[model samples]
Target: MSSPRPVWTGLVTVVLAVAPALAACSPEAAPPARADAPVIVPGAPGQSGSGPARSPAEAGPVAADVRFAEAMIPHHRQALEMAGLAAARTGDPLVTAVADRVADGQRPEIAVMESWLRSLGRTPPPAHDHGTGDHGMSGYGMASEEDLTRLRTARGRAFDTLFLTLMIRHHEGAVGMAAQELRRGRDRAMRAMAQDVVSGQQIEIARMRGIQRRLASP
Candidate 1:
C-alpha cells in the first residue's frame, strides 16, 4: 500500500464532501426542528398572533364568527377612541400607559377581524356605532354620547377614573361577546380569537379594578 496517512486523509475528505448530500437524502438524518423555533401564526392579511395553531381541516367560519367580527370591529374602535383621549388629558403615567395598551391591543385585533371578513368574501363594514340589536349588552358595549362627552371633557383624576370605569364595562361586554362566540362559533380561527379576547379582557378588567381602587383612596 501507498502511505497510510495519504489514504486516511483521502477517506476523511470524501466523508466530509458527501456528508451534506447524505443528510439531504436521508430523512432519518435530517436536522430536527428546534424546540425554540419561532412559531408564526398568521393574523391579519400579513401579520401573526401568538399561541397554538388551529387544525388545517377546521370548518369554515359560521354565522357566529361573522357576527363576532362585525360587532367587535366597532366595539374595538370605540375603545381606541376612548384610549386616545387619555394621552392629552391625563397627568398620570400609569393611566396613559394603560390607555396605550388598550389602543395597541385592540388595533391589531381589528385588523385580524377585518382580514377574516375579507377572506370570507365579505366586504368590511364601515366604521360606525356598535349595534346591540337582540344581543343587547351581550354583544357590544358602546359608550353613549353622554358617556363619551364626559370622558372627552374630563381631566386629571376624573379622566383616569372615568376611563377605567368605561373600559372595565367595555371589557365586560367583550367577555360576554367572547362567551357567545365560544358557544356558537364554528370556525377554529374565530373561536381561538374569541378565547383570546375572553382571557385577555378578563385580565385587563382585573387590572382596571385595581387601578380604580387605587384612585378611590384619598
Candidate 2:
C-alpha cells in the first residue's frame, strides 16, 4: 500500500533472514563441543627412527639369523632321530609319548627353517648332518655320535632315563641358541622362531626333569 515496498527489497530481506539458518545447517558447520574425532599427527620429516612397522616376512635376515636357521635345522633333525628310536626301544608310555610329541613338534619346524633358508638363497644343512665338532654347533647341546649310539642300543627303563636326560640337555642347548638369536638376530621371523624354541623347549625341559624324578623315585 505504501506504493508496495520495492520487489528487490523484499527479495534482499528474505535472503538476509535465511542466511544465518543456512550457515547453521551447512556441512562445514563447526562440530559440537563433545566431538571426539581423532587427530593424527604425522612424524617429523627425516626423523631418525625404526621407521614404519613391517611384518617378519618383509624384514631381511642378518648373519645371526642365517646361522640360527642353519644350526637349528640339523639340531632338530637329531632330536627327531632320537624321538624315532623311543617307540621301538622304550617300554615306558611316558617316554613314547614325549618322543612322539618331540617328533611332531620338531618335524614341521625343520621344514620351516629349510624353506626359510631356501627363500634367502642359502643352502640348508643336510638331514644327516649333525653339525658337531668344527661345525661349531656342539655348544648348543647337540648329542654326540657316541651318545646316539648308546641311546640306540639301550633298552627298557635304561633307554627311558637316558633319552629323557639327553633330550633335556638337547632342549637346554636349543634354549641357549634361541637366546643368542634373540640377542643378535635381525630377522623378525627367525627371532620369533627363536622365541618359540626358547619357550617350547623350556617347558619340555621341565617335563623331562619331572619324568626323570619320577623314574628315579620308583
- TM-score per prediction, in order, is 0.69, 0.72
> Model 1, residue 12: displacement in angstroms?
48
lDDT of 1 by residue, 49-137 (tens): 45354442343444566677778887888889899999899998878877877876777777777766655456565766533233344
- The TM-score of candidate 2 is 0.72
Residue-pair clashes, model 1? 0
Worst 10 residues of 2 by lDDT: 31-40
Per-residue lDDT value at 149 in model 1: 92
Candidate 2 per-residue lDDT, tens place, 72-157, comes to 88888889989999989988887887898788777767776776665544567886685454355767788888999999999999
Candidate 1 residue pairs in clash (backbone atoms < 3 Å):
none
Which regions of candidate 1 are displaced past 4 Å? Answer: 1-57, 128-139
